[model samples]
Target: MKNVFTTLLLFSCLISAPSITAADERVKIIPDVVYGHKFGMALTFDVFQPEKPNGAGVLFMVSGGWYSRWTDPQNMLSWFKPLLDEGFTVFCVRHGSSPKFKIPEVVEDVRRSVRFIRLHAKDYGVDPSRLGVWGGSAGGHLSLVLGTTSDKGKPEAKDKVLQESDRVAAVAAYYPPTDLREFVDEKSPYYQRFPALQFDKELADDFSPLLQVTPDDPPTLLIHGDQDKLVPISHSENIMQQFKEKKVPVELLVIENAAHGFRGDDQTRASQAVVKWFQKHLAKQAD
Candidate 1:
Protein backbone atom coordinates (compact mmCIF):
# COMPACT_ATOMS: atom_id res chain seq x y z
CA MET A 1 0.00 0.00 0.00
CA LYS A 2 1.23 3.46 -0.83
CA ASN A 3 0.00 6.42 1.19
CA VAL A 4 0.99 10.01 0.39
CA PHE A 5 0.87 13.17 2.42
CA THR A 6 -1.09 16.04 0.89
CA THR A 7 1.49 18.71 1.57
CA LEU A 8 2.75 21.16 -1.03
CA LEU A 9 5.80 18.92 -1.54
CA LEU A 10 5.67 15.15 -1.54
CA PHE A 11 8.51 12.57 -1.51
CA SER A 12 7.96 8.87 -2.22
CA CYS A 13 10.64 7.03 -0.24
CA LEU A 14 10.47 3.98 1.94
CA ILE A 15 11.42 3.54 5.58
CA SER A 16 12.23 -0.12 4.90
CA ALA A 17 13.87 0.70 1.57
CA PRO A 18 17.45 0.99 2.91
CA SER A 19 17.41 -1.64 5.65
CA ILE A 20 17.01 -4.71 3.43
CA THR A 21 19.40 -3.70 0.69
CA ALA A 22 23.12 -4.20 0.07
CA ALA A 23 23.28 -1.21 -2.30
CA ASP A 24 22.99 1.06 0.69
CA GLU A 25 26.25 -0.16 2.25
CA ARG A 26 28.10 3.13 2.00
CA VAL A 27 25.15 5.09 3.31
CA LYS A 28 25.24 6.50 6.86
CA ILE A 29 22.54 7.95 9.11
CA ILE A 30 24.02 10.27 11.75
CA PRO A 31 21.70 10.38 14.75
CA ASP A 32 22.39 13.56 16.78
CA VAL A 33 24.91 16.34 17.08
CA VAL A 34 24.61 19.89 18.38
CA TYR A 35 25.54 22.54 15.78
CA GLY A 36 24.91 25.92 17.48
CA HIS A 37 24.31 24.75 21.02
CA LYS A 38 25.47 27.89 22.80
CA PHE A 39 23.16 30.65 21.62
CA GLY A 40 20.41 29.27 19.38
CA MET A 41 19.97 25.98 21.19
CA ALA A 42 21.22 22.63 19.87
CA LEU A 43 20.49 22.04 16.18
CA THR A 44 20.94 18.58 14.63
CA PHE A 45 20.96 16.71 11.29
CA ASP A 46 20.85 13.23 9.74
CA VAL A 47 23.42 12.66 6.97
CA PHE A 48 22.88 9.89 4.40
CA GLN A 49 25.58 8.79 1.99
CA PRO A 50 25.60 6.66 -1.16
CA GLU A 51 27.48 3.41 -1.81
CA LYS A 52 30.44 3.47 -4.18
CA PRO A 53 29.55 7.07 -4.87
CA ASN A 54 29.54 8.14 -8.51
CA GLY A 55 29.87 11.87 -7.75
CA ALA A 56 30.65 14.34 -4.99
CA GLY A 57 27.46 16.18 -4.13
CA VAL A 58 25.02 16.60 -1.28
CA LEU A 59 21.24 17.18 -1.40
CA PHE A 60 20.33 18.85 1.85
CA MET A 61 16.70 18.99 3.06
CA VAL A 62 15.61 21.22 5.90
CA SER A 63 12.26 20.51 7.58
CA GLY A 64 9.28 22.89 7.50
CA GLY A 65 7.90 25.34 10.12
CA TRP A 66 11.26 25.66 11.96
CA TYR A 67 11.11 22.97 14.61
CA SER A 68 13.64 21.76 17.17
CA ARG A 69 14.62 18.09 17.28
CA TRP A 70 13.36 15.48 14.78
CA THR A 71 11.60 13.31 17.33
CA ASP A 72 9.46 10.17 16.79
CA PRO A 73 11.16 7.04 15.46
CA GLN A 74 9.02 5.80 12.54
CA ASN A 75 7.56 9.23 11.88
CA MET A 76 11.01 10.77 12.05
CA LEU A 77 12.43 10.23 8.56
CA SER A 78 9.80 7.89 7.06
CA TRP A 79 9.89 8.33 3.26
CA PHE A 80 13.32 9.71 2.31
CA LYS A 81 15.51 6.76 1.33
CA PRO A 82 15.43 7.41 -2.42
CA LEU A 83 18.35 9.86 -2.53
CA LEU A 84 20.63 6.93 -1.68
CA ASP A 85 19.36 5.15 -4.78
CA GLU A 86 20.06 8.30 -6.77
CA GLY A 87 23.77 8.33 -5.84
CA PHE A 88 23.85 11.66 -4.04
CA THR A 89 24.61 12.22 -0.36
CA VAL A 90 21.49 13.48 1.47
CA PHE A 91 21.13 15.41 4.70
CA CYS A 92 17.90 16.02 6.66
CA VAL A 93 18.42 18.77 9.19
CA ARG A 94 16.56 19.96 12.31
CA HIS A 95 16.52 23.59 13.39
CA GLY A 96 14.30 25.72 15.65
CA SER A 97 10.73 25.44 14.31
CA SER A 98 9.04 28.74 15.21
CA PRO A 99 7.94 31.06 18.10
CA LYS A 100 10.59 29.29 20.17
CA PHE A 101 13.00 30.70 17.58
CA LYS A 102 12.41 33.51 15.14
CA ILE A 103 12.87 33.24 11.37
CA PRO A 104 16.32 34.86 11.54
CA GLU A 105 17.61 32.34 14.08
CA VAL A 106 16.11 29.44 12.16
CA VAL A 107 17.73 30.55 8.92
CA GLU A 108 21.06 30.90 10.76
CA ASP A 109 20.77 27.30 11.88
CA VAL A 110 20.45 26.26 8.23
CA ARG A 111 23.55 28.27 7.31
CA ARG A 112 25.47 26.55 10.09
CA SER A 113 24.35 23.18 8.81
CA VAL A 114 25.73 23.91 5.35
CA ARG A 115 29.06 25.04 6.79
CA PHE A 116 29.22 21.95 8.96
CA ILE A 117 28.65 19.67 5.95
CA ARG A 118 31.21 21.46 3.77
CA LEU A 119 33.83 21.51 6.55
CA HIS A 120 33.57 17.76 6.95
CA ALA A 121 32.88 16.75 3.35
CA LYS A 122 36.15 14.86 2.95
CA ASP A 123 35.50 12.72 6.01
CA TYR A 124 31.95 12.33 4.75
CA GLY A 125 33.21 11.01 1.40
CA VAL A 126 32.32 14.01 -0.77
CA ASP A 127 33.73 17.31 -2.02
CA PRO A 128 32.91 20.50 -0.19
CA SER A 129 32.12 22.58 -3.26
CA ARG A 130 29.68 20.10 -4.77
CA LEU A 131 26.71 20.66 -2.51
CA GLY A 132 23.00 21.20 -3.29
CA VAL A 133 19.88 21.59 -1.16
CA TRP A 134 16.11 20.97 -1.51
CA GLY A 135 13.14 21.52 0.74
CA GLY A 136 9.44 22.42 1.03
CA SER A 137 7.69 25.36 2.68
CA ALA A 138 9.94 26.96 5.30
CA GLY A 139 12.64 24.51 4.37
CA GLY A 140 12.35 25.77 0.80
CA HIS A 141 12.79 29.32 2.04
CA LEU A 142 15.99 28.37 3.86
CA SER A 143 17.28 26.43 0.87
CA LEU A 144 17.22 29.63 -1.20
CA VAL A 145 18.65 31.62 1.67
CA LEU A 146 21.52 29.20 2.23
CA GLY A 147 22.06 28.80 -1.47
CA THR A 148 21.95 32.51 -2.26
CA THR A 149 23.24 34.25 0.85
CA SER A 150 26.19 31.90 1.16
CA ASP A 151 28.73 34.61 0.32
CA LYS A 152 27.59 36.56 3.37
CA GLY A 153 29.25 34.08 5.72
CA LYS A 154 32.84 34.79 6.71
CA PRO A 155 35.34 32.54 4.93
CA GLU A 156 38.12 32.61 7.54
CA ALA A 157 36.75 31.17 10.76
CA LYS A 158 39.04 28.83 12.68
CA ASP A 159 36.40 26.17 12.23
CA LYS A 160 36.77 25.02 8.64
CA VAL A 161 33.01 24.53 8.44
CA LEU A 162 32.43 28.14 9.43
CA GLN A 163 35.12 29.17 6.98
CA GLU A 164 33.30 27.56 4.07
CA SER A 165 30.51 29.57 2.43
CA ASP A 166 27.02 28.11 2.96
CA ARG A 167 26.49 28.00 -0.79
CA VAL A 168 24.95 25.10 -2.66
CA ALA A 169 25.43 24.33 -6.34
CA ALA A 170 21.71 23.83 -6.95
CA VAL A 171 18.32 23.77 -5.27
CA ALA A 172 14.86 22.16 -5.68
CA ALA A 173 12.03 23.90 -3.88
CA TYR A 174 8.45 22.59 -3.54
CA TYR A 175 5.52 24.92 -2.98
CA PRO A 176 7.63 27.15 -0.76
CA PRO A 177 6.61 30.49 0.68
CA THR A 178 9.25 32.78 -0.82
CA ASP A 179 7.86 35.88 0.86
CA LEU A 180 6.49 35.64 4.38
CA ARG A 181 4.87 39.05 4.41
CA GLU A 182 2.82 38.30 1.33
CA PHE A 183 1.87 34.90 2.71
CA VAL A 184 0.47 36.32 5.93
CA ASP A 185 -1.31 39.18 4.25
CA GLU A 186 -3.27 37.07 1.81
CA LYS A 187 -4.81 33.65 1.68
CA SER A 188 -3.44 31.36 -0.98
CA PRO A 189 -5.85 30.06 -3.63
CA TYR A 190 -5.88 26.62 -2.03
CA TYR A 191 -7.60 26.13 1.29
CA GLN A 192 -5.02 23.90 2.88
CA ARG A 193 -1.68 25.60 3.69
CA PHE A 194 1.22 25.21 6.11
CA PRO A 195 2.46 28.33 7.82
CA ALA A 196 3.77 28.41 11.38
CA LEU A 197 0.82 29.85 13.31
CA GLN A 198 3.18 32.21 15.06
CA PHE A 199 4.30 34.28 12.07
CA ASP A 200 5.56 37.76 13.07
CA LYS A 201 4.32 40.52 10.80
CA GLU A 202 7.17 42.88 11.60
CA LEU A 203 10.01 40.53 10.69
CA ALA A 204 8.44 38.51 7.87
CA ASP A 205 9.81 40.70 5.09
CA ASP A 206 13.37 40.50 6.39
CA PHE A 207 13.29 36.71 6.24
CA SER A 208 11.65 36.26 2.85
CA PRO A 209 13.83 34.07 0.62
CA LEU A 210 12.59 35.67 -2.62
CA LEU A 211 13.60 39.08 -1.27
CA GLN A 212 17.22 38.00 -0.76
CA VAL A 213 18.26 36.24 -3.95
CA THR A 214 21.21 37.90 -5.74
CA PRO A 215 22.62 37.66 -9.24
CA ASP A 216 25.26 35.22 -8.06
CA ASP A 217 22.78 32.88 -6.44
CA PRO A 218 22.98 29.23 -7.44
CA PRO A 219 20.67 27.81 -10.07
CA THR A 220 17.25 26.83 -8.70
CA LEU A 221 14.20 24.67 -9.46
CA LEU A 222 10.95 26.02 -8.06
CA ILE A 223 8.05 23.50 -8.08
CA HIS A 224 4.52 24.38 -7.14
CA GLY A 225 0.96 23.42 -8.09
CA ASP A 226 -1.27 25.99 -9.81
CA GLN A 227 -4.08 25.18 -7.37
CA ASP A 228 -1.93 25.34 -4.30
CA LYS A 229 -3.69 27.49 -1.71
CA LEU A 230 -1.14 27.24 1.08
CA VAL A 231 1.66 28.59 -1.04
CA PRO A 232 0.26 30.39 -4.04
CA ILE A 233 1.70 29.74 -7.46
CA SER A 234 2.07 33.53 -7.48
CA HIS A 235 5.01 33.19 -5.15
CA SER A 236 6.74 30.92 -7.64
CA GLU A 237 5.74 33.32 -10.38
CA ASN A 238 7.22 36.22 -8.46
CA ILE A 239 10.45 34.32 -7.87
CA MET A 240 10.77 33.37 -11.52
CA GLN A 241 10.52 37.04 -12.37
CA GLN A 242 13.27 37.92 -9.88
CA PHE A 243 15.46 35.05 -11.00
CA LYS A 244 15.18 36.39 -14.54
CA GLU A 245 16.11 39.88 -13.40
CA LYS A 246 19.16 38.54 -11.53
CA LYS A 247 20.01 36.38 -14.55
CA VAL A 248 20.26 33.29 -12.36
CA PRO A 249 19.27 30.02 -13.94
CA VAL A 250 15.90 28.96 -12.56
CA GLU A 251 13.26 26.40 -13.55
CA LEU A 252 9.78 26.91 -12.19
CA LEU A 253 7.05 24.25 -12.56
CA VAL A 254 3.36 24.84 -12.07
CA ILE A 255 1.31 21.66 -12.09
CA GLU A 256 -2.26 22.03 -13.30
CA ASN A 257 -5.08 21.65 -10.77
CA ALA A 258 -2.50 20.53 -8.23
CA ALA A 259 -2.60 21.52 -4.61
CA HIS A 260 0.36 21.53 -2.25
CA GLY A 261 1.34 17.88 -2.84
CA PHE A 262 0.77 17.94 -6.60
CA ARG A 263 -0.05 14.28 -6.02
CA GLY A 264 -2.50 13.04 -8.64
CA ASP A 265 -0.96 13.90 -11.97
CA ASP A 266 1.90 16.07 -10.75
CA GLN A 267 4.02 14.05 -8.28
CA THR A 268 5.85 11.67 -10.61
CA ARG A 269 6.51 14.27 -13.27
CA ALA A 270 7.73 16.88 -10.81
CA SER A 271 9.99 14.39 -9.04
CA GLN A 272 11.52 13.41 -12.36
CA ALA A 273 12.11 17.05 -13.16
CA VAL A 274 14.02 17.47 -9.90
CA VAL A 275 16.20 14.45 -10.72
CA LYS A 276 17.02 15.94 -14.09
CA TRP A 277 17.85 19.31 -12.53
CA PHE A 278 20.25 17.73 -10.05
CA GLN A 279 21.87 15.62 -12.73
CA LYS A 280 22.52 18.71 -14.80
CA HIS A 281 24.10 20.89 -12.10
CA LEU A 282 25.09 18.89 -8.99
CA ALA A 283 26.42 15.86 -10.85
CA LYS A 284 28.43 17.90 -13.33
CA GLN A 285 30.11 20.23 -10.85
CA ALA A 286 33.84 20.92 -10.86
CA ASP A 287 35.82 18.64 -8.58
Candidate 2:
Protein backbone atom coordinates (compact mmCIF):
# COMPACT_ATOMS: atom_id res chain seq x y z
CA MET A 1 0.00 0.00 0.00
CA LYS A 2 2.84 2.41 0.80
CA ASN A 3 4.56 1.73 -2.49
CA VAL A 4 1.29 2.15 -4.35
CA PHE A 5 0.62 5.48 -2.69
CA THR A 6 4.16 6.67 -3.48
CA THR A 7 3.60 6.01 -7.17
CA LEU A 8 0.21 7.68 -7.07
CA LEU A 9 1.60 10.78 -5.41
CA LEU A 10 4.36 11.15 -8.00
CA PHE A 11 2.05 10.66 -10.98
CA SER A 12 -0.32 13.27 -9.59
CA CYS A 13 2.36 15.97 -9.38
CA LEU A 14 0.80 17.41 -12.51
CA ILE A 15 -1.54 20.35 -12.27
CA SER A 16 -4.82 18.68 -13.35
CA ALA A 17 -2.99 16.77 -16.11
CA PRO A 18 -4.27 18.74 -19.05
CA SER A 19 -4.02 17.29 -22.56
CA ILE A 20 -1.17 18.64 -24.66
CA THR A 21 -2.06 20.67 -27.73
CA ALA A 22 -0.35 22.79 -30.38
CA ALA A 23 -0.09 25.42 -27.67
CA ASP A 24 2.78 23.31 -26.36
CA GLU A 25 4.74 25.07 -29.07
CA ARG A 26 4.52 28.17 -26.90
CA VAL A 27 6.93 26.46 -24.50
CA LYS A 28 10.49 25.69 -25.55
CA ILE A 29 12.25 22.86 -23.76
CA ILE A 30 15.95 22.47 -23.04
CA PRO A 31 16.48 18.91 -21.83
CA ASP A 32 19.14 17.19 -19.72
CA VAL A 33 21.12 20.31 -18.83
CA VAL A 34 23.83 19.09 -16.46
CA TYR A 35 24.02 20.95 -13.15
CA GLY A 36 26.68 18.96 -11.28
CA HIS A 37 28.48 15.61 -11.09
CA LYS A 38 28.61 12.97 -8.37
CA PHE A 39 30.48 9.68 -8.44
CA GLY A 40 31.18 10.25 -12.18
CA MET A 41 27.43 10.63 -12.99
CA ALA A 42 25.88 13.86 -14.23
CA LEU A 43 23.08 15.56 -12.30
CA THR A 44 20.61 17.26 -14.66
CA PHE A 45 17.36 19.26 -14.99
CA ASP A 46 15.11 20.25 -17.90
CA VAL A 47 14.15 23.84 -18.62
CA PHE A 48 10.73 24.79 -19.99
CA GLN A 49 10.53 28.39 -21.17
CA PRO A 50 7.17 29.91 -22.05
CA GLU A 51 7.32 32.26 -25.07
CA LYS A 52 6.24 35.16 -22.93
CA PRO A 53 8.30 34.57 -19.84
CA ASN A 54 7.68 36.29 -16.52
CA GLY A 55 11.46 36.28 -15.79
CA ALA A 56 10.99 34.14 -12.70
CA GLY A 57 11.86 30.42 -12.31
CA VAL A 58 10.05 27.69 -10.37
CA LEU A 59 11.99 24.48 -9.81
CA PHE A 60 9.97 21.27 -9.37
CA MET A 61 12.00 18.76 -7.42
CA VAL A 62 11.69 15.48 -9.32
CA SER A 63 11.65 13.00 -6.47
CA GLY A 64 9.40 10.28 -5.02
CA GLY A 65 10.40 8.36 -1.96
CA TRP A 66 13.75 10.10 -2.57
CA TYR A 67 14.10 8.32 -5.92
CA SER A 68 14.57 10.71 -8.85
CA ARG A 69 13.23 8.83 -11.84
CA TRP A 70 13.48 9.94 -15.46
CA THR A 71 10.75 10.04 -18.11
CA ASP A 72 10.21 11.62 -21.51
CA PRO A 73 10.35 15.39 -21.13
CA GLN A 74 7.54 15.75 -23.67
CA ASN A 75 5.18 13.90 -21.34
CA MET A 76 5.62 16.66 -18.78
CA LEU A 77 4.21 19.46 -20.93
CA SER A 78 0.63 19.10 -19.78
CA TRP A 79 1.79 18.32 -16.29
CA PHE A 80 3.34 21.76 -16.03
CA LYS A 81 1.10 23.70 -18.40
CA PRO A 82 -0.43 25.75 -15.59
CA LEU A 83 2.95 27.19 -14.61
CA LEU A 84 4.03 27.54 -18.23
CA ASP A 85 0.82 29.41 -19.02
CA GLU A 86 1.66 31.76 -16.19
CA GLY A 87 4.96 32.62 -17.95
CA PHE A 88 7.16 31.04 -15.30
CA THR A 89 10.22 29.17 -16.52
CA VAL A 90 9.77 25.72 -14.98
CA PHE A 91 12.87 23.73 -14.00
CA CYS A 92 12.35 19.99 -13.43
CA VAL A 93 15.34 19.05 -11.29
CA ARG A 94 16.35 15.45 -10.57
CA HIS A 95 18.64 14.67 -7.68
CA GLY A 96 20.67 11.50 -7.07
CA SER A 97 18.32 8.63 -6.30
CA SER A 98 17.94 7.25 -2.80
CA PRO A 99 18.92 3.80 -1.28
CA LYS A 100 22.17 4.78 -3.04
CA PHE A 101 22.59 8.45 -2.13
CA LYS A 102 20.62 8.76 1.15
CA ILE A 103 18.88 11.95 2.33
CA PRO A 104 21.98 13.94 3.28
CA GLU A 105 23.55 13.54 -0.16
CA VAL A 106 20.18 13.96 -1.91
CA VAL A 107 19.64 17.28 -0.11
CA GLU A 108 23.11 18.52 -1.11
CA ASP A 109 22.51 17.46 -4.72
CA VAL A 110 19.36 19.64 -4.92
CA ARG A 111 21.13 22.53 -3.20
CA ARG A 112 23.83 22.34 -5.87
CA SER A 113 21.22 22.27 -8.62
CA VAL A 114 19.75 25.56 -7.31
CA ARG A 115 23.19 27.15 -7.10
CA PHE A 116 23.96 26.08 -10.64
CA ILE A 117 20.70 27.54 -11.91
CA ARG A 118 21.26 30.81 -10.08
CA LEU A 119 24.81 31.07 -11.45
CA HIS A 120 23.52 30.77 -15.00
CA ALA A 121 20.20 32.54 -14.48
CA LYS A 122 20.95 35.26 -17.05
CA ASP A 123 21.67 32.73 -19.78
CA TYR A 124 18.28 31.13 -19.11
CA GLY A 125 16.57 34.58 -19.22
CA VAL A 126 15.52 34.49 -15.59
CA ASP A 127 16.20 36.61 -12.52
CA PRO A 128 18.11 34.55 -9.94
CA SER A 129 16.43 36.41 -7.11
CA ARG A 130 12.94 35.64 -8.42
CA LEU A 131 13.03 31.87 -8.05
CA GLY A 132 10.48 29.60 -6.30
CA VAL A 133 10.19 25.84 -5.70
CA TRP A 134 7.52 23.10 -5.61
CA GLY A 135 7.23 19.35 -5.01
CA GLY A 136 5.30 16.56 -3.21
CA SER A 137 6.17 13.99 -0.52
CA ALA A 138 9.93 13.55 -0.43
CA GLY A 139 10.26 16.30 -2.98
CA GLY A 140 8.13 18.49 -0.72
CA HIS A 141 10.43 17.75 2.19
CA LEU A 142 13.34 18.86 0.05
CA SER A 143 11.54 22.01 -1.05
CA LEU A 144 10.93 22.96 2.56
CA VAL A 145 14.55 22.25 3.38
CA LEU A 146 15.62 24.61 0.64
CA GLY A 147 13.19 27.25 1.82
CA THR A 148 14.16 27.19 5.46
CA THR A 149 17.82 26.29 5.39
CA SER A 150 19.18 27.84 2.19
CA ASP A 151 22.40 29.73 2.79
CA LYS A 152 24.77 32.41 1.52
CA GLY A 153 27.61 31.15 -0.61
CA LYS A 154 31.01 30.31 0.77
CA PRO A 155 33.26 33.21 -0.26
CA GLU A 156 36.41 31.05 -0.28
CA ALA A 157 35.01 28.14 -2.28
CA LYS A 158 36.98 27.38 -5.43
CA ASP A 159 33.93 25.94 -7.20
CA LYS A 160 32.00 28.81 -8.75
CA VAL A 161 28.66 27.10 -8.15
CA LEU A 162 29.47 26.83 -4.47
CA GLN A 163 29.89 30.59 -4.45
CA GLU A 164 26.26 31.16 -5.49
CA SER A 165 23.40 31.46 -3.00
CA ASP A 166 20.69 28.79 -3.07
CA ARG A 167 17.87 30.94 -1.70
CA VAL A 168 14.44 30.95 -3.38
CA ALA A 169 11.67 33.57 -3.26
CA ALA A 170 8.88 31.17 -2.22
CA VAL A 171 7.99 27.52 -1.61
CA ALA A 172 5.01 25.19 -2.16
CA ALA A 173 5.32 21.74 -0.60
CA TYR A 174 2.59 19.08 -0.61
CA TYR A 175 2.32 16.36 2.08
CA PRO A 176 5.92 16.88 3.16
CA PRO A 177 7.57 15.25 6.13
CA THR A 178 8.86 18.38 7.85
CA ASP A 179 10.26 16.63 10.89
CA LEU A 180 12.53 13.63 10.27
CA ARG A 181 13.22 12.78 13.89
CA GLU A 182 10.76 9.89 13.77
CA PHE A 183 13.01 8.12 11.28
CA VAL A 184 15.79 8.24 13.83
CA ASP A 185 14.00 5.60 15.87
CA GLU A 186 15.48 2.31 14.68
CA LYS A 187 12.17 0.54 14.89
CA SER A 188 10.12 3.13 13.10
CA PRO A 189 8.23 1.94 10.01
CA TYR A 190 9.75 4.64 7.76
CA TYR A 191 13.29 3.52 8.58
CA GLN A 192 12.74 0.19 6.90
CA ARG A 193 11.32 1.48 3.64
CA PHE A 194 13.01 4.83 2.98
CA PRO A 195 16.70 4.00 2.95
CA ALA A 196 17.07 7.67 2.20
CA LEU A 197 16.25 8.24 5.85
CA GLN A 198 18.97 5.82 6.96
CA PHE A 199 21.39 8.55 7.97
CA ASP A 200 23.06 9.38 11.27
CA LYS A 201 20.48 10.16 13.94
CA GLU A 202 22.35 13.28 14.99
CA LEU A 203 22.05 14.68 11.46
CA ALA A 204 18.25 14.29 11.45
CA ASP A 205 17.77 17.79 12.84
CA ASP A 206 19.95 19.21 10.08
CA PHE A 207 17.67 17.80 7.38
CA SER A 208 14.34 18.35 9.15
CA PRO A 209 12.77 21.56 7.80
CA LEU A 210 10.70 21.94 10.96
CA LEU A 211 13.91 22.38 12.94
CA GLN A 212 15.50 24.66 10.34
CA VAL A 213 12.94 27.44 9.96
CA THR A 214 14.06 31.05 10.41
CA PRO A 215 12.24 34.40 10.34
CA ASP A 216 13.66 35.29 6.92
CA ASP A 217 12.56 32.05 5.27
CA PRO A 218 10.57 32.65 2.11
CA PRO A 219 6.77 32.76 2.14
CA THR A 220 5.52 29.17 2.01
CA LEU A 221 2.33 27.33 1.11
CA LEU A 222 1.78 23.80 2.40
CA ILE A 223 -0.99 21.57 1.09
CA HIS A 224 -1.86 18.22 2.64
CA GLY A 225 -4.72 15.77 2.54
CA ASP A 226 -6.43 15.44 5.88
CA GLN A 227 -6.70 11.67 5.44
CA ASP A 228 -3.21 11.01 4.13
CA LYS A 229 -1.93 7.94 5.96
CA LEU A 230 1.47 7.64 4.32
CA VAL A 231 2.61 11.03 5.63
CA PRO A 232 0.09 12.26 8.12
CA ILE A 233 -1.38 15.76 7.98
CA SER A 234 0.25 16.35 11.35
CA HIS A 235 3.52 16.89 9.52
CA SER A 236 2.19 19.99 7.82
CA GLU A 237 0.28 21.10 10.87
CA ASN A 238 3.36 20.94 13.08
CA ILE A 239 5.54 22.94 10.71
CA MET A 240 2.72 25.38 10.06
CA GLN A 241 2.89 26.15 13.75
CA GLN A 242 6.60 26.85 13.59
CA PHE A 243 6.18 29.07 10.53
CA LYS A 244 3.51 31.01 12.38
CA GLU A 245 5.66 31.36 15.49
CA LYS A 246 8.54 32.68 13.42
CA LYS A 247 6.22 35.17 11.71
CA VAL A 248 7.21 33.86 8.27
CA PRO A 249 4.44 34.25 5.78
CA VAL A 250 2.77 30.82 5.54
CA GLU A 251 -0.53 29.15 4.69
CA LEU A 252 -1.69 25.57 5.09
CA LEU A 253 -4.50 24.32 2.87
CA VAL A 254 -5.93 21.07 4.19
CA ILE A 255 -7.93 19.08 1.68
CA GLU A 256 -10.63 17.36 3.66
CA ASN A 257 -11.16 13.60 3.05
CA ALA A 258 -8.30 13.40 0.54
CA ALA A 259 -5.60 10.76 0.86
CA HIS A 260 -1.83 10.59 0.29
CA GLY A 261 -2.11 11.76 -3.31
CA PHE A 262 -5.12 13.81 -4.35
CA ARG A 263 -7.47 12.55 -7.03
CA GLY A 264 -10.49 13.88 -8.94
CA ASP A 265 -11.33 17.45 -7.93
CA ASP A 266 -9.01 17.41 -4.92
CA GLN A 267 -5.89 17.37 -7.08
CA THR A 268 -7.19 20.24 -9.19
CA ARG A 269 -7.90 22.37 -6.17
CA ALA A 270 -4.44 21.71 -4.67
CA SER A 271 -2.86 22.53 -8.01
CA GLN A 272 -4.66 25.86 -8.27
CA ALA A 273 -3.67 26.77 -4.73
CA VAL A 274 0.00 26.22 -5.49
CA VAL A 275 -0.15 28.24 -8.70
CA LYS A 276 -1.89 31.12 -6.93
CA TRP A 277 0.60 31.07 -4.06
CA PHE A 278 3.59 31.33 -6.40
CA GLN A 279 1.96 34.10 -8.37
CA LYS A 280 1.30 36.08 -5.22
CA HIS A 281 4.87 35.82 -3.94
CA LEU A 282 6.94 35.58 -7.14
CA ALA A 283 5.03 37.91 -9.46
CA LYS A 284 6.09 40.98 -7.52
CA GLN A 285 9.72 39.89 -7.73
CA ALA A 286 9.40 39.34 -11.47
CA ASP A 287 8.01 42.85 -11.89
Top TM-score prediction, candidate number: 2
Q: Number of clashing pairs, model 1?
A: 6
What TM-score do all the candidates reach, one by one? Answer: 0.80, 0.95
Model 2, CA-based lDDT? 0.89
lDDT (tens digit, per residue) of candidate 1 on 1-287:
01212342333121223234454444666666556664545677766666655455655554544434454323333244455567776676777765466667677778888888777787777777778888776667777777666764575667666776787888888877787775455353221133353455677666777788789888999998888866688888998889999999998987888876655347677767777787788775453
What's the distance in Å from true for residue 221, model 1? 0.3
lDDT of 1: 0.66
Top candidate, metric lDDT: 2
Error of 2 at 50 (Å): 0.5
CA lDDT, every model vs. true structure = 0.66, 0.89
After best superposition, candidate 1 residue 152: deviation in angstroms? Answer: 4.9
